[model samples]
Target: MSWIRSWKRLGLFALLGLVLSWAISCGSGTPPSTTGQQPSGKQEVEFWTMQLQPQFTDYFNQLIATFEKENPTLKVRWVDVPWADMERKILTAVSAKTAPDVVNLNPNFASQLAERNAWLNLDEKVTPEVRQLYLPNIWQANTLDGKSFGLPWYLTTRIAIYNTDLLKQAGVSKPPATYAELAQAAKQIKAKTGKYAFFVTFVPEDSGEVLESFVQMGVQLVNAEGKAAFNTPQGKAAFQYWVDLYKNGLLPKEALTEGHRYAIDLYQRGDTAILASGAEFLNTIATNAPTIAKVSASAPQITGETGKKNVAVMDLVIPKDTDVPDAALKFALFVTNDANQLSFAKAANVLPSTVKALQDSYFQTAPVNATPVEKARIVSAKQMQSAEVLIPAMKNMKQLQKSIYDNLQAAMLGQKTVDQAIADAAQEWDSRQ
Candidate 1:
């Protein structure tokens, strides 16, 4: 009986010891039991960016590498897709619940995404310190319904880049300051130099930039109700202005088929005397055709009717599914901060989106062709302060822009009269609405 009791006591003591050991292990912060198995390594985050191939590929890769080096515990993988297919791919990924952990997108889509609750509300993530890094205007542009969706990574604006040699050849000493002056100059240049003086890449059916030109001319495309209001008297007048230019032989017929890229190429190749485009063209010229580097750029002339300068904006946005929202927002803030903005601006020949960066010493310094770039930058900065946002009709904006330009092109080719083209375009715009 004594031996049996001893064995029972020994068994009870062993059980207590085991229980204590298990408790201690838990208290020591041993890995908790997960449903399946423990992950082998640190968390990996997938990031997607709009097509950043050959030109910006290295810069972006280095930036990501630096981010990983600074964050040893986090791994970031990148996916690059071309701009044309980006929206479609991203939407597909979102639908499949396979969206990237971080995404960079344009601001125009940010509002739509926000409306659909497809983007993270960055207001909670971005600190006041982070907000101060970008220009107020850009920050506002990315904000929809009082919430910020993304940061402005880089920015570009349209400026009138003209062929200085052509201007000299035409005996025009100065660039046009107003639309009327521009028209008069265009007439004189065409008459004397036998070259198109102005090119409008406005295609009513597909050219968003052409619509932007109308907006710059103070033609409101939509009212408070978001209905298409571009067929108003002011809109008609703006459309007529383009028709007049086409009829007078001041603009090329090719402009109807030419989008922004085509117009920039024409000016770069010295086929046209003037082009309204972003500073990215500067780098394009430097890389593609070194000889045309002598061409200069100036502020896009204000129209005689509206006296308003037009500037288009591009911005950055965060998608809804970013896992490390805080860290992603911080990185965005870091990149757009004044110093990083300067770095990007210099690398891309794009204007800085922040006030501090724009006023930096680098931008103030005159380039080889100082006058035009400086003038354009100053005017663009001012215009950006009051730029209007374009919200197209509910259906077929691309078709509408194409139709307007197709008719105008016909007019330029002498296949239709200016009145006929304008009337037909108006009818088409009305029918589309």
Candidate 2:
């Protein structure tokens, strides 16, 4: 059975590699290098980004134009890749020595890339003044082992998105503040409205999103020694908490396979009364399903186990072998600067990663939509200072994350008791090492 599983995993990865290779072969050409002594005249830099389409195109273009006007001799060529294909494409480009001058990446992936020595250290490029402009926590996320490889582009944090109409029907006067209150409220919402209390998509291979919250609840997935520790007392309790919620029918069984989009859809259709997601969901709800926009965003209730709130950050980084390191750094700073940060915040509803941008008039006094962006912005900003960083085990995080979540899914589905599932996960983690 183990051998069969290994073969299946290898096959899946092989298929992904083939698909990535095919995509890279069709691209226009290799991304140009902008480093190694500035060109005598025009220095053209290639900037690659993930699908920042219709909403962010104008703002990004404007920022580029302004930067070019100021720099005069430097020119930037922007290439956009869809998010679905981003990881595969970027890795292929890097391996083929055809990578972009600069690239934007999520913080979670940034750390992994840095571990492989794939990103350039930006410590020397950023001046004290430039560093001061960004939020302290945002800057910290971009640094790994004393090297700064990326800049914080935009920030996001999860919040409790509740259906106001459903709450009213349930006779709940307000959102819950404690985990106990939240569970009770969920039960009440379901009894009165015949809808699930909360929607969370938990899958074995895709557990990072939900695991982030569990970590915030004081469940340590890894110990200080960087060893897998999710089978500990804290971790077991956190797993049991979710399992109980599932057994009580307060959560949907589909959560085992659902993704963020699916949960958002359930919230929009009023099939679920609460969702734990980022601010982007507000824009999505408003645009895709207007009725759901009527819901309100509030701070997520604390876990009874730990009173601390959890926020996960997505960071942007520059790869080490980037051809135009200077140009890449400049562009990274430009995009994350105060002016452009506000533009991105307004258009994408993402919290700005810079302190000044977050304090700007647009974010400070932005008008309330039915699902006010302010709620998320305020909560994220307040929590940013103390938010826990996402630090999975560096050595075998991919395997460890998969093992922990596979057992978690089993517990959630009643296939195994929480203790049994956790014990199994620990055994798997040890064997893999």
Candidate 3:
């Protein structure tokens, strides 16, 4: 579900409309009209989601049908938006007061609108008993400034996918479980097999894995006051760690500009020994690179000494100005309830944010005849017990990424010392705050 953040589906016909729609959508954005109501007097609420069309269309249509059957007076209009266009579409839609009643978005983008009070404050809307339905940490992700703006939906956590052949070539019996072990294996794999141990982009705007790594390494991103906190001794060490990795040629050169896709390419091409990504990728590798898939095995994500892991959450947010706030919350809760979440998690190959849904036997235990993908699912689901959104959702999150990454790159290229890079990145963030 979180992959939609980086996934772009086909379209330029839509791209042309993007610029125009962006402007109009932001112009006092219009909320869905009441005009769509049928003669039966059922109130209609619109739901918007990132690119999940075609593949999940049938699933959702049935879900909506089922919901409507239960709530006879409420009708839902499902809008499936392309992934790349979400930001512009939402911005335009929200500003015009025409935003959907309930929308699916990640905290990274949703936080921006939340700061403007564009989304309803769920703390007041949902009862305390209702709040107890979700995993505490997952629910915590939707809160900003002590107010909840959304309810957690689907989740994703990465697991280590390693090539056994490559490990054998490097004389390593097991894939590394910690960053320290990963660093050592990187060198051994490089020397023995002439392959990188893994691929993680250094590109400022790409995957947030590297940034999450810093936190896993015990570097606080921002302090209690919400100012930059990554300039401490721990932060300097984290910066230097990446610098050394790049300078020593352990990371691929393309990492400087490439994104997670490139990491997948390298892993599939057998140029990297491991791929840290969603468990669903095991099925992908099995199809794309059967040879590699045959020898691949799943392990826990490479963590720092702290053993922290990162989780990606897709949330359900209701616009503050929506005409059907109560209806929206009810539908959202229905969509995310344990039964619905379990069904979607199974259909979508993602983890569920609902506590009971996650405790289902499907997630808790792999069958005796489980395939690699099945076992990986358990590994991913298990991480939910500890994984969380490492980067705190905030306004201008991309700016924070850019600052730290640009500085870190400079240090790697010998343009700045590690200390200077960390200091500069911290100052830039504080200035913005």
Q: Which predicted model would earn the best lDDT? A: 3
List all candidate RMSDs to the true structure: 18.7, 6.5, 4.3
Taken over the whole model, the C-alpha lDDT of each candidate is: 0.59, 0.66, 0.82
Give per-residue lDDT, candidate 3, residue 298: 95
Please, what is the TM-score per model? 0.76, 0.84, 0.93
- Alpha-carbon error at 262 in model 1, in Å? 3.2
Q: Write the per-residue lDDT of candidate 2 for residues 53-145, one digit (tens) a residue.
A: 544568778888999998887888777665556677777777776677778666666677777888877787888888888777667767767
Between candidates 2 and 3, name the one with more favorable lDDT: 3
Q: Residue-wise lDDT of candidate 3 within 45-79, one digit each (tens)? A: 88887766656779999999999999999999887
lDDT of candidate 1 over 85-144, digit per residue (tens): 556666776665566666666566556566677777878877787688667766776776
Clashing pairs in 2: 35-324, 107-315, 119-319, 119-320, 120-319, 120-320, 150-317
lDDT of 2: 0.66
Arrange candidates, best lDDT first: 3, 2, 1
Model 3, global lDDT:
0.82
